[model samples]
Target: MGETNVKLASINPDAQKARDLLRIVIVGHVDHGKSTLVGRLFHDTGSLPDGKYESIKAMCERRGVPFEYAFLMDALQAERDQGITIDTSQIWFKTEARDYTIIDAPGHKEFLKNMITGAAQSDAALLIIDAAEGVREQSRRHGYLLHLMGVRQVAVAVNKMDLVGYEQEQFDLIEEEYRDYLRSIGVEPTFVIPVSAREGDNIANGSKSMPWYKGPTVVKALDSFLPNAPLVDQALRFPVQDVYKFDQRRIIAGRIESGRLKVGDTLMFSPSNKTAKVQTIESWSAREDFTPPSEAAAGQSVGITLDEQIFVERGELISHVEEAPIETEVFKARLFWLGHEPLTAGKSYKLKLGTFDTPVTVQKVDRIIDTSDLSNSESEQVERNQVAEVTIRSRRMLALDEFTSNGRTGRFVLVDKYDIAGGGIISMEGYADQRAMIMATKSTNITRVEHGVSIEERARRNGHKGGVLWFTGLSGAGKSTLAVALEKLLFEKGYNSYVLDGDNVRHGLNANLGFSPEDRAENIRRVGETAALFQRAGMLAITSFISPYRSDRDRARAAAGDGFHEIYVKADVETCKQRDPKGLYKKAIAGEIKEFTGISAPYEEPDSPNLVIDTAETPLEECLETLVNYVERNFRV
Candidate 1:
């Protein structure tokens, strides 16, 4: 030690109450001395319980093994036996400046899940690197994981300096390499210092071994980190945990994850699109005569009563109407997978966000990321411990925020069967929020007029029932080809039918619409409404368009109701491009066309379609016969 060691202070109860507490997780490659560092910090600060150190030394003596600092932190029998940490261990620590909770996270590759659990709860991180080994692959992986988990404040400790003769050159090399790696992932390390944990050098005091080095000790670096500010300024994200009834009063109970709310504030619950005003903010206090709280903010578990009774359930997000979360069935995610089975596209899993739970399918595995090198590669499935960027689709709309906007409501976990298999943060780079669009109906004075002629009478006059044959797929998947043939055959069979091709409709009904997502949605809205009217008129409205989004098609289904039939025109992108019926695919691939489905843009496959026409393998005549038989069998009334 560089300075005279003062007598260690005992943990003062009075000081603990007034001081801010910070949770710091120590992580790195296995055998990088994370445990030894933790053990030394306790001994240097004199925070260990009386007789706990002596007992641990005695246990090592009885076992006929040399005493090591790592034994102090590896308290579990399994850990001591294996000489490796397998789970997370939380212990209290204190510096002269603040009270601290030290979370010792496992650094082994197989115990990555335990590491993630620890990191997710931490406010900052202390990453250890073995000087002799320098930056290993696991070190890079840990850095990426920390970034993925949103741990921004980081300090790097180049431990085992004694093994390398406390050389400044070696420490500097490791620091520079690892620093560049962290910065590549958008993490700027606050400090990087060389220390010997076992010798108690540069931990609580300055290091005498390295006279040329001048920096704050590990304790000083930790004390300098500030606590995260309260989330009062962010948008409201109150996820309903449960609903309770007492004396004919229904109270919505949940933890306010962000923002503040007062009585009389209007709240909009999402996925249901219902609204209510907060009548009372209920909180339990020790005093019996305590009146309800006038307001509540983030980190408070509260119950609120609404001014009106409405149907609400767990997992509904509550927000102010003006700044509500995005409601969409699909969104992009960057996730770290920990499942035993590979995460493949088209596979379904249960997603848990806040209290919201819904079944979601992996629509596309965009790319597999190599964390150690930060390289990307295309893969159909993401293996265990692999990170991937993927598109996830839920059958129903979910209310969520972008992780950058609000982390508490944007992060989620994936459950496979019964186990949590993966976790991720949400991003909406190219996708729309859809909250405003979904709730944009402004009609106030309109009436639906029932026709005098019954549906049965119309069906009898047309010689068949009516329907909207919705054809959806990629651009060159033979939708127009099959739809027109089906319409002609149905007409020859004495059934009233019409073909609404994409180009033909765009030239007239949707002439005003552009190719933007919002315009495309509006175009589909108009087409769905028109097709439904045609269905009501006892005619088969055959629609052919590259309706790529599942949500858009679902809206069309809702408009047409039971008379809607979704026909999937199936063809792989490569096959469709090879056919190049209209040369659109060539233009899309050549960058002449923007936002082209199956090329530059996305094409969502239907989860379940009424019928599938495989144009690549099936002949045109056979495909036509399948269509004709389906219409004749179902439409004949």
Candidate 2:
């Protein structure tokens, strides 16, 4: 659009300085002109690196592809070959008034996971729509995702105006429809511009072609756009990314998402929930008394030194003692399934929220929304690229907030076994209010078989208290053998003890379970819950299993609570086969068992085990002695 006196020089420098740089991501369906808009903006602003345009131009000619504007931003070879942006690309440009970091996101549905990754870091969004095509499936879906991601600021760039004959009616019609759609989902676009990115009309510079429709060019609109500052003055919330100890100082570095952080200010760390006073505020050789939530706020990296030597770690949030963050065991969230496989309930996966990664299970699927109609559908499971409202139960208690309130801590990604399959944002907290919903679904039936009293009371009764001795090793590595020996030793010491061997569980408890990855996850979940019950009943629960996945072990650790002790029954695979107590390894080699741990499947060794017994070199009694000693040291009252 053409607007007079809207030159770049007219922008206010003070406004630019006060506002933090908002990184906006432009995303839409394939052939939606996302790249062209970015390329035009760069060309209009004279920010294209020298010789880059000519290089892309020559490559396009040699490759027999058209010298299109999209080629300018397609840096990846796969993108150039496929004629589609497969990965998100970042480009830095400036308007007269403000600096902008534009992220060009991939448009293919297959790469939607990558798109979400890019969206996770963006402050706002620019949704591109084709004027002639109106709104496509991806155009609507991406907008929905942006809303779900909590990107409140949006602008629709209706491209291909030249193809539509620069018609005012076409632009207005598309804008009106999209605005209605946005309103339905609680999103409102600040501006809607009609432009031909290919022709460089009404982008960085105003075009003479659109005289009938007068509005600020894309660049001018961006420059004039005011970004909301971080609420640093309100309650302080700092999520610690890391705590480093150098020389004598303890340095904590993280983004302060909401409140202001200053030197000498006292902050409480969660999970541990310890309070520590800030010693100094430091960033890039600049020391200050206070730092506001500007572009320079929470998103920008900062470091601080605290006065106390508290037990602070990564994944813990720091806040004012008064507001103290909420810690919960289970919550409801809206997840977008991006994996090839369907997301099924009761399946355990790695849940990564903020900097914390723990095992979690999808308890139930509440409702699945069809992207085309934006209507809710009753579904048993959500397939790839589908969005669903699901209830998730974390293995460990987590500190989280609503996505609308705090995007940083509310968002989470689900890692299926090894691959990250989907992501979600916390929509509602506490338990679901629907009693019927809970009744319709099956509970995680962990048998609470009480021989007499509860584990806590029993531990108090027995002179030597009860706790879980988690034994992890290869199938034939004597995990069960050692556990049985330890159980007898504990029993002889007048302690109530029970050994939950893998084979024994498979016979009764996990009778329906198989060796598949999904089944393995369930197996571990059941075992963890059982161990938790046993620990509560004051009985020494010795669980011996491959356990295979680190996420599974982490879940067991959480379920076992404070008295959980992990013992690595370390033995090489070859040595394990030499023993071959059940000859299962031999059968596995004969293809009798598929997805066997240490063979077809993976086994993640505990990185920081409390006890490591090398059964390969050490004798049985020696290994048991080491484990018993370690357990006695940590769990003895």
Candidate 3:
């Protein structure tokens, strides 16, 4: 991948002469004049090779077809015959200020993947729209793709103005409509200019036909877009590609994605929390006894030896000790699916991000977004060529970063079987970075004090073994009601039992925490630890809370070990809303409450539970009897 990125820069031979080279991708609806605009830009800027224009004109005459600037870019005979671009094409042109590599991507729906391939490497974008036909569905889809791919610098070209008679009203209407759509999706167009790509109006020079219009020409806009900031100034992201051995020295090699590294700098490997100082920076050289460089910056591929040997492998991210990436087992992603089969929930796929690879499952399908109309719909599966937001889960903790935080490490592709099925950008919106919590040590001088009483003695005195019965479900699902009733029954039957209701604990123990996802995880963590202690003291701890995230629930299970029992109180959202015990559902539906589970927030159901009580359908007496029997069979001394 690093070698491929190196080739992208050398495509433009004039790169050495210009101060900066900006890669721009052009996309639009089919027949929106994207090719014509690109060809015209090259011709008007005098960047076309000698005799390249006349040769195309003669070919057009021999075929008895009209001459079109688009023919210059549609070089493939098959593309000219079909009159639609089928693949991505690259061209080089220059303005007085800087050089440009214009990537002309296909505008057809069937070729959208090719378009994504071209746009993914671009620094900025140029979106073309037809003035006469207005903004079509494909035009809106292309705009959304640019936003998803993280291209912020964009310019809109209202092409084929000749067909619209160079009227300012038509251009204004189209501009207003498209500008509103782009803004809704968090994209702001830098410029909106009207141009006739075939006639070369407003492309390289001002248009006299449209006297009332005032905007920079296409060439001027290309020159005005600023180059991206130097990647060396950002946080370090060095993903290990391989570990090598040379003359009894173990060297780790990788390309620096961002920031810099020098000898003696302490580097931390994420997801493992291992740290080592850089002993030496190694590079390939032909001459013997060559002096190795002491430092390396972003875009350089170099090897290094650690001060001391430790277990290290490929796919671990290397960063400064204080600026490490996020270590998490799950994250939210916005991805585009291109697989033959629809992307469905609970399906497993291989996720490839940077040098890391892991088996990930689709935890849930959040929503499918219609790029054409910008409407969201809940669907069980994402069809081919559709964009969807979904939750992804890995089997274990993985090192990564949020796309918004670090694009290089956060972007990933999903491999279905052996085929590349989808691509996405990562967002840790509702998830926690568990590195600090996992590695944190509150006190170093303290030791765990062992209890004097034996477990068997405590069980004999309490008449039952101590354990945690964790009831999890949506609000108004009868979790608290069932838990309290069970607590009373267990106490009357000569067993020590207590109920830890969500609201009751929130009033005191969790008073400092809010309903945010992060706070909720922390709350669950505290409750799990407290419940484990209760069990150790020979008491049955029944806990009731709407634990929405699976990872948090898993943490609670880990805390209690074999003493945890997951009791799923199953009830659909409609049933829960209909049985609003505390009127919380009504408030949530009326917008008075935000981030309420089963309404504004998400609730991930337990994949496998020890007990599933269908409170929505079963009678209270029968449910209580079933719970009593299960406890008698398992927990009785």
The residue-by-residue lDDT of candidate 1 on 435-512, one tens digit each, is: 656877889898989999998899998889999999998887899999988888888889899988889999998999
Q: Rate the local accuracy (lDDT) of all candidates.
A: 0.88, 0.77, 0.88
Q: Write the per-residue lDDT of candidate 2 for residues 158-241, one digit (tens) a residue.
A: 999999899999998999989988888888898899989999988977878889867888887777666655555556677777
What is the overall TM-score of model 3 with all chains considered together? Answer: 0.90
Q: What is the lDDT of candidate 1?
A: 0.88
TM-scores for all candidates: the values are 0.83, 0.61, 0.90
Clashes of each: 0, 9, 0
Compare candidates 1 and 3 on TM-score and give the better one. 3
For candidate 2, give the lDDT of residue 445: 69
The lDDT, on a scale of 0 to 1, for candidate 2 is 0.77
Q: List per-candidate RMSD values in Å.
A: 7.2, 16.2, 3.6
Q: After aligning candidate 2 to the native by TM-score, how far in Å is the CA of 262 from where it should be?
A: 2.9
**Can you tell me which runs of candidate 2 are displaced by over 4 Å?**
1-20, 58-66, 231-234, 247-258, 280-306, 429-637
lDDT of 3 by residue, 176-240 (tens): 99999999999999999999998999999999999888889999998999877777888999988
lDDT of 3 at 605: 88
